[model samples]
Target chain A: MREFFERLGLMAEKAVVTTGQIIIMLFQAVYYLFLPPFKFRNMFKQMEFVGVRSLFVVVLTGSFTGMVLAMQGYNALKRFGAESLVGPTVALSMARELGPVLTGLMVTGRAGSAMATELGTMRVTEQIDALYTMAINPVKYLVTPRIVAGVLMLPVLAIITDFVGVLGGYFVGVKLLGINPGVYIGRTIDFVSVNDIFYGLTKSAVFGLIITLISSFQGYHASGGAEGVGRAATSAVVLSCVLILVSDYFLTSIMF
Target chain B: MVKLSAEAKVGIFVLIGIILLAYMSLRVGGMRFGKEEGYTLTVKLDNAAGLDRDASVKVAGVEVGRIKDIKLQDHKAVVVLRIKPGVRIGRDFTAALKTSGLLGEKYLELIPGSPNAPYLEEGEEITRVRAYADVDKLIADLSEVAVDIKKVTGSMAKVLGGEAGAASLSNIVSNLEEITYNINAVVEQNDERLSTVLANLEVFSDSIKEVAAGLNVLIKENRDDFTAGVTNLKAAMETLNSMAPEIKHTVSSIQRIARRIDEGQGTIGKLINDDTTHEKLNRTLTGINSFIDKTQRFRLYVGYRGEYLFDADDTKSYLSLRIQPKADKYYLIDIVDDPRGNRRTTKTEVTEGGSTRTVETTKTSDEIKFSAQIAKRFGDLALRGGIIESTGGLGADYYMFKDRLKLTLEAFDFHKDRNPRLKAGAFMYLNKYFFITAGYDDFISDVGLESAYVGVGLEFEDDDLKYLFSSVPPISF
Candidate 1:
C-alpha cells in the first residue's frame, strides 16, 4: 500500500512538473511573438503546411459529417413532420461546434505530430545545444513561427470546413431527401448567423495555440534519440486531440 | 497557369477562406454593409415568448421587414421593427406574433386595418398589437378541459353501471319502439286519404295558376288603356289639389258661422238663443210673410255690368240683382265699385303760433257703394225713383223698337254745393240676357266731374241662376 501511495505521489508530481513546463513554454512563445526579428517566411511555410495542406481531408470530413447529420436529422424530424429543419440542424452544428473541433483534431494529427517529430529530432541530435552555444534562443526560433501559424491558420481552416459542411448539407437535404430547396436555404439562413461562425473560429484559435504549444513542449525536452522522438510525436498528437475536445466543451458553455 | 509558390498558395487559401466567410455573413446571415435601408417602428406584444430578434415581419404573408430587436419592458415584449423603405405601414395596422408551423419560429405579421388609413411615420409605435397565444397555455387549458371531461365520463359510467340502470335504458328503448310502431300504424291507415287530399290540393293549385295567367294576359292587353286612365286620374287629382285651400277656406268660414250661432254671438244666434229676440224675429217674419205672399211669385235676375270711363281712364263694375214681383213692378239692388270714390269736406280749427284759424280739407275714400231702386213700366215707358249709385235719385226709361233699345235719364245729390248730377244713357240689348250701354255721368255738375262711359251687362234669370249655382263646384263642410 505504501509503494502504491508512493507511486501515485510520483505520478502526481510528474504531472504537475509537466503542466508547469508547458505553461512556461507558452509564455516564452507569446513573449517572443511580440519581439522584433519577425519570421514571416516561416509563418507562411507553417501556414501552408497546417491550413492549406489539410484542406482536402478537412473538406472530406466536414462534408460527410454534414451529409450524415442531414440524413439523421431528416429521419428524426420527419417523425415530427419537420423534415425541413435538417438544413438548419446541419448548418448550426458545423458553425457552432463541429467545424472548429474537427479541424483542430485533423490538424493535430497531421501537423502537430510532424512538428513534434522535427523538434524532437533536433533536441536528441544535440542541434538544440549547438544553437544555445551559438547564443541563439531555440524556443523563439523554432516555436514562435509555428504558434503564429497555428493561431492564424486554424480559424481559416474552420471557415473552409463550415462552408463545405453547409454546402454538403444543402446537397443532401434538397436533392437526396427531397426537401423544398427554398425552404432548406431559407431555414438555414434564418437560423445561422455570423456570430455562430465566429464562435467556432474563436474556439479554433484557442485550439491552434494549444496544439502548437503542447507539441513544442513535449518535443523540445526530448532526451532519447529515435524512440523518444517517436514517443514525443505520439504524445503530441494524442494530447492535442484530447485538449481540443475538452476545451471545446468549456468554451461552448462559456461563449454560447 | 504558372506553378504557384508555397507562400502564394497560402495567401490564396487564406483569401478564399475569408471570401467564403464574408459570403456566409452577408448572404446567409443577412449582415448589412452600410446603413440599413428602412424605417424603424416599435411594437409591444403580450406574450412574445417564442419570438426572436431578426425574425421576419410579413404583411399579408409577404416579407417586408425584419424584427430588429426585442426588449422586455414592464413584463411585456417590445419589438423594434426595421421595415423596407417603400413599404408603408398604416396607422390602423395590427402586429401579431405568429408561428410558421406547429413548432416553427415566431414571426411578426402586420395586418393592415384599412386601405385609406394614414401611414405611420418613422419611430411611431404600432399600438394595435395582437396578443400571442402560447402553446403551453393552450395545452394547459386543454388539460383542464380533459379533466372535466373525465369527470363527466366517470359520472356517466356510474349512472349507467348497474342492472337497474340498464333496465331503465331498455325500458326507454322499448317505449320509443312502441311509440314509433303506433305512429307507423296510424300513418299506414291514413296513407290513401292523405294521398287523395294531396292530389286535390295539387289540382287546386294548378287551377289557381291558370287564373293568375289569365289575369296577367288581361293586364298586358289593356296596358295602353290603363296608362291613359292613370293619366286622366292624375290630372283630376292635380286640379283638386290646387283647389284644396279655397275649399278649406269656405268650409272653415261655414264652420265659424255655425259655431257663432251655437255660441249666441251673431244676429241669427241672438234670434235663436234669446227668448225676446226670438219673439221679435217671429213677429217680424210673420209680418214679412204677408208681403212675401205677394212676392211669392217673385223672379230674380242676377246680372253683372262693367263700364269704362273716358275722362277717368278707369273702370267701374256693378253686381245687380233685380226682383220682379209683378209683370210691371220690379226692385233693383246693385253693389258697385266706383273709381270716383266718395268725397267728403271737413273744417278743423287750428291754434298754432298764438293764432286761431280754420283749415278746410276734402277727403275721398274708395269704398264700395250700393244702390236700391224701384221701377214701374207702362206701354214700354218706365219711371224709377230710389237710391242710384249710393244717392237718392230719380230716373226715366223710354223703350224703343219693341223694347230691344232703351234710353235712360237720372239726377241725384241735390243737397251738394254743386248742381244736381244728371246722367243719360242709351241701352242696346243684343239678347234677352246681354246689353250694351253708352252714358254721360254727372254731366250737369259745375265741378267738371263729367265723364262719358261705355258699359256691358249680363243678366241671368231664375232658371239660368239655378243652373249656374248647380254648376259651381261643391264645397264639403
Candidate 2:
C-alpha cells in the first residue's frame, strides 16, 4: 500500500510538471507571435501539412460518422414514430460535438506526430543547441509557425468536416432511408443554428493550439538518442489526443 | 498539371473551406449576409417557453423571416419578429407561437388579417396574439385531475368501508320495498271506482247505438207520409201556373225598388253606389271565390276494403272517404262493419241458501263504428292522429319504392283493464286503385283479442269514377 501510494504521488508530480511546461510553452508561443521575421512561408507550409494533407482522412471520418449517426438515429427515432428526426440528429451531433473532435484527433495523429518527431530529432542531434550557439531564438523559429498554422487551419479543416458530414447525413437520410428530401433539409436547418457550428469551430481552434503546443514542447525537451525521439513522437500523439478531448468537455460546458 | 507551391495549395484549400463555411452559415444556418433583410415587429405573448431566438417566422406555412430577439416585460414575453420584404402585414394580424411537430421546434406564425385592413408599420407592436397550446401545461392539468381523482377515491373508501355502510345500504333497500307496497295498496283501494267508470263508458256506448237504431225507425215510420206530401206538391204546382200574371205584377214592384237603390236615394243605395265600398265588396267576393275554387280543386277518393280475420272467422268491411286539400295533408273517414262486436262484461255476486256464487254476464253489440282522422305527410312517411275505429289513436305509414309499398302501424283503445290495441300491416299496391294488405290486430293483448288479418281494397278518385261511368255501354229497352 505504501509503495502504491508513493508511485501514485510520483505520477501526480509528473502530471503537474508536464501541465506547467505545456502552459509555459503556450505562453511562449503566444509571445513569439508578434516578434520579428514573421515566417509566413513556414506558416503556409505547416498549414498545408496540417489541413490540406489531412483533408481526405477528415472527409472520410466525417462522412462515415454522419452516416452511422443517421442509421442509428433512424432506428431509435422510428420506434417513437419520428424517423424524420434523423436529419437534425446527425447535423446537431456533427456541428456541436463530433466534427471538431474527430478533426482534432485525426490531425493530432498525423501532423502532431510529425511535429514532435522533427523537433525531437533536431534536439537530440544537437541542431537546436547549434541554433542557440549561433545566436538564434529556437522557440520563435521552430514552434511559432506550427502553432499559428494549426490555429488557423484546424477550423478550416473542421468546417470541411461539418460540410461533408451534413452531406453524408443528407444522402443517408434522404436517399437510403426514404425520408423526404425537403423535410430532411428543413428539419436540419430548423434545429442546427449558426452558434452550434461556431461552437465546434471554436473548440477546433483551441484543440489546434493544444495539439501543436504540446507536441512542440515534447519534441523540444526530448532527451537520450533516436529511441527518445520515437518516444517523444508517440507521447506527443497520445497526449495531444487526450488533451483535445479533455479541453473539449470544458469548452462545451462553458459555451453551451 | 502544374506543380503548385505549398503556399498556393494551402491557399486553395483555405479558400474552399471559407466558401463552404459561408454556405453553411448563410444557407444552412440561415445567417443574414451583411445587413438583415426585412422589417421587425414586436409582439407580446402569454408564454413563449419553447420559442427561442432565431426561430422561424412563418406566414401561411411559408417562412418569411425569423425571430430576432425575446425579452420579458411585465411578466409577458416580448418577442421581436423580423419579417421579410414583399410580405405586407396589417395591424390586425394575429401572432401565435406554434410547434412544428410533436416534439419539434417552435416557430412564430403570423396570420394575416383582412386585405382591406390598414398596413402595419415596421417596429409596431402586434396587439393580437394567440397563446400556444403547451404540452407542459396539459401534463400539469392531467396531474391535477389525477390528484382530485385520488382524493375522491380516498373519501369514498372512508365513507363506505365497513359493516355500518352495508347496514345503511340495506336500510335504503327496505325503504324502497315499503314505498312500492304502499303504492300497491293504493291501487287496490281504487279498484272498485275504476270498474264503475268502465261501466259508465259501456252505458255511453249503448246510448250511441240506441240513437242510431231510433233514427232507422223514424225514417221507416215517415215513408207513407212522405208519399202523401209529394201528391200534394203536384196539385200546388198547377195552382202556381194560374198565378203567373200576379207574379209578374210583384216582379215589376221589385224592379222599381232596385231603380230607387240605383239612384242613391236610401241607405241601401249609398252602400251599393259608393265607389270605394263597392270596390272593397268586390275584392272580398273575389277572395272568397278564390278560396272556394281552391277547395273545389282538392282531390276526393272513395275506397272500399274487406278484411278476413283468421281467428275470429269473420270479414270486416270498410267504406272510406278521403279528402285531400294539399299534397301532404288529408282527412279520412271510414264507416266500419266490425263482426267482432263491442263487448261489455258485467259481474255480480248472488248469495242463495248461505252459499255465495259470482255470476259473469257478457253482452255484445253489433254496431257501425266510424273513424275520422287528419293526416300530414313528410317525405315517405305520414303521421295521423284523431280517432281510429271509434277510439282516439295514433298511426304512421312508411312508404317505399315510389310508394308502391307501405308499412302501417296504429295503437289505440288504451283501457285500464286491458293492454292497448296495436295493429301493424303492410300494403302492396297492385295498381293505382287496387291493393292487398295483411296485418296483425290487437297483438299487444294476451286475452285472445289478437287476430291475423288479410284484406283487399279498391280506391278511386272522383275523376276515375266519372270515367268508369262514362265508359259503360248504354242499355236498350
Candidate 3:
C-alpha cells in the first residue's frame, strides 16, 4: 500500500512539474517572440518544415475523412429524409473539430517526434551545453523558432485541410450520391459560419503550442543517450495527441 | 555545391501561408481589411440572448454584416454592427434576434423594408427590434393547455362510460332501427296505390298528346293567316320604332315648350300667360259649352272613315257630314280619297315580225270626290237619294237601338260600270263615336271592284269635331 501511495505521489509530482514547466516555457516563448534577435530565417525554415512539408499528408487525410463523413452522414440522415444535410455535416465537422484535432495529431506524429528526437540527440551529445559555454541560450537558439513556427503553421495547415475536406465531401455527395448541388452548397453556407472556422483555427494554434512545448520539454531534459531520445519522441507524439483531443471538448463548449 | 538560399525557400513558403491565411480569414472568418472597407451601424436591444461580438447580421437569411462589438448600456445591451459594402439596409428594416436552429447558434436577422426607402446611414441606430422567443415559456403554456384538454376529455369519457348512458345509447339505436323498419313497411303498403297513380298519370299523358296534336293541325291550317298577322305586327312595330327617336325629339321640344311657358318665353308662352289670349281661350271654351248644351238646335253629325283594301293593297279614307234640317230630315255629304277610281287600257299586238306598234293604256285612276244626299227619318228608318263618288245613288237606312245599329243600301256608278255598282252593309255602334261596318261592296253583278269588306269609322257631332280639328296643327298636304 505504501508503494502504491508512493507511486501515486510520484505520478502527481511529475504531472505538476510538467504542467508548471509548460506554462513557464509558454511565457518564455512569448517573451522571445517579441525580443527577437528575430530569427526570421529560422522561423521561416521551421515554418517550411512544419507547414509546407505536411501539406500533402494533411490534404490526403482531410479529403478521405470528409468523403467518409459524407457517406456516413448520408446514410444516417437518409433515415430522417434529410440527405441534403450531408454537406453541412461534413463541412461543420471538418471546420469545428476534425480539421484541428486531426492536423494536430498528424503534425505531432511527423514534426513533433522529429523535434523531440533532434533536441534530445543534441542534448545527449552535449551540443546544448556547448551552446551555453558560448553564452547563447539554447532555448532561444532552438526551441523558440520551432514554437513560433508551430503556432503560425498549424492554423494554416488546418485551413488547407478544411478546404480539401470540403472538396472531397462535394465530390462524394453530389457526384457519387446524387445529392442536389444547390442544397448541399446552400446548407453548408447556411449552417457552417465563420465562428466555427475561427474556433477550428484557434484550436489548431493552441494545439501547435502544446505540441512544441511537450516535444521541446521532453527533449531539453532528456538524459539517456539513444534510448532517451527515442522515448522522448514517442512520449511527445502521444502526449500532444491526447492533449489535443482532451482540450477540444473544453474549447467547443466555451467558444460556442 | 549547394547554391540555394534557405531564406528564399522559407520566404516563398511563408508567402504561400500568408496568402492562404488571407483566403481563410476572408472566406471562413468573413474578415476584411482597410479603414473604410465596410459601414458601421448601432442597434440597441432589450435582451440579446446568446449573442456576442462577431455574431452574424443577416438579411433574408443571407449574412451581410456582423456584430462588431456589444456593450452594456443603460439597462440595455447595445450592439455595433459592421456591414459589408453594397448591402442596403433600409431605414425601416426590422432586426430580429433569431436562432440558427433549436438550441443551436443565434444571429441578428434583419428583415428589409420596402426597397425604395432610403438606406440606414452609417452610425444610425436600427429602431425596429425583436427579442428572441423564450421557448421554455412557450412550452410551459402549451403543456398547461394540454393538461386542461386532458381533464375535459377525461370527464367526457367518464360520462360516456356510465351504465345509464350506455342503456340510453342502446335504446336510441334500437328506436332508430324501428323507425327505419316502419318506413319500409309503409312504403310496401302503398305499392298498389302508387301503381294506380302511375296509371292515371299515363291517361293524363294521353290527353296531353291529343291536345298537342289538335294544336299542331290548327297551326298548319292558319299558317297564312298567322303570317299576315305577323307581317302586320312587324309593319306596326317598324312604324313605332321609326317614330321613337322623333318622339324623343318631340318630347324634348315639349319639355322646352313647357319650360318656355313657365318662363313666359315666345308667342305660345305669351298666349298662355297674357291676359288677352287667356280671355280669348276662355271665351271660345264657353261658346263650345253653350253649343254642346244646345245640341237639339243643330244636331249635325260628322264621321271619318279609313278602309284597307286587301285586293288593291291600299287604303281609302273619307270624311262624312250629316246636317239635320229638322227633327226627322238630314243632309249627308262625303269626301273620299279612293285608291281605285277608274281604269282604261289599250292593247295592240304586231301580226308580222319587225312591224312597230305601240299602245297607251290607263289601268286605274285614283281621285278625291264628294257625294251628297238628303234623307227623311220615319221612326227607325230613313230614305235617301244622292251622288255616290260623283254619280247618282240611293240608300235606305234602318236604325235600331237608338241608332246604335244601321243597315244601308246604295246603288251608284251605273254609267261608268257595266252594271250599277251596289253596296250593302250594316253598321254596328261600338261606343259613343266608333262603329264597325262590314259590307258586300259592288256585289250586285260582280263586274266592278267587288269585295266583302270590313271597316271602322268614328261618328260625332260636326260642330264638336270641327272645333277639335281647328284646335290641332293643320295638315299641310
Q: Cα lDDT of all candidates, in order?
A: 0.88, 0.88, 0.83
Misplaced by over 4 Å in model 3 are: B1-5, B17-477
Docking category for candidate 3?
Answer: acceptable
lDDT of 2 by residue, B267-383 (tens): 899998898998999999998887556555667799999999999999989999887767898889999898987665667899999999998787877668889999999999999
> Interface root-mean-square deviation for each candidate?
1.1, 1.1, 2.8
TM-score of structure candidate 1 = 0.56
Tens digits of lDDT, candidate 1, B1-477: 998787999999999999998888886657344578889999988777777877899999998988898999999888999999999999999998899987778899999998999999999999998766586878988999999999999999888879988998899999999999999999899999989999999999999999999999999999889999999999999999999999999999999999999998977897888898778878999978865564455567899988899998988899998877677888888998988876665779999999999997878776588889999999888998899878898889999999999999988767656588898999999999999999998898676679999999988887565344334546100
Query: Model 2 off-target regions past 4 Å?
Result: A1-14, B31-34, B37-44, B89-97, B108-477
TM-score of 3: 0.49
* Residue-level lDDT tens digits of model 3 in B118-222: 888889999998755488668988999999999999998787788977988899999999999999998799989988999999999999999999999999999
Per-residue CA lDDT of candidate 3, range A173-202, in tens? 999999999989877876677778888999
True contacts kept of each: 0.91, 0.79, 0.40
In candidate 1, position B39 carries an lDDT of 96
lDDT of 1 at B304: 95
In model 1, which regions exceed 4 Å deviation? B1-3, B31-34, B72-75, B132-477
Top-DockQ structure, candidate number:
1
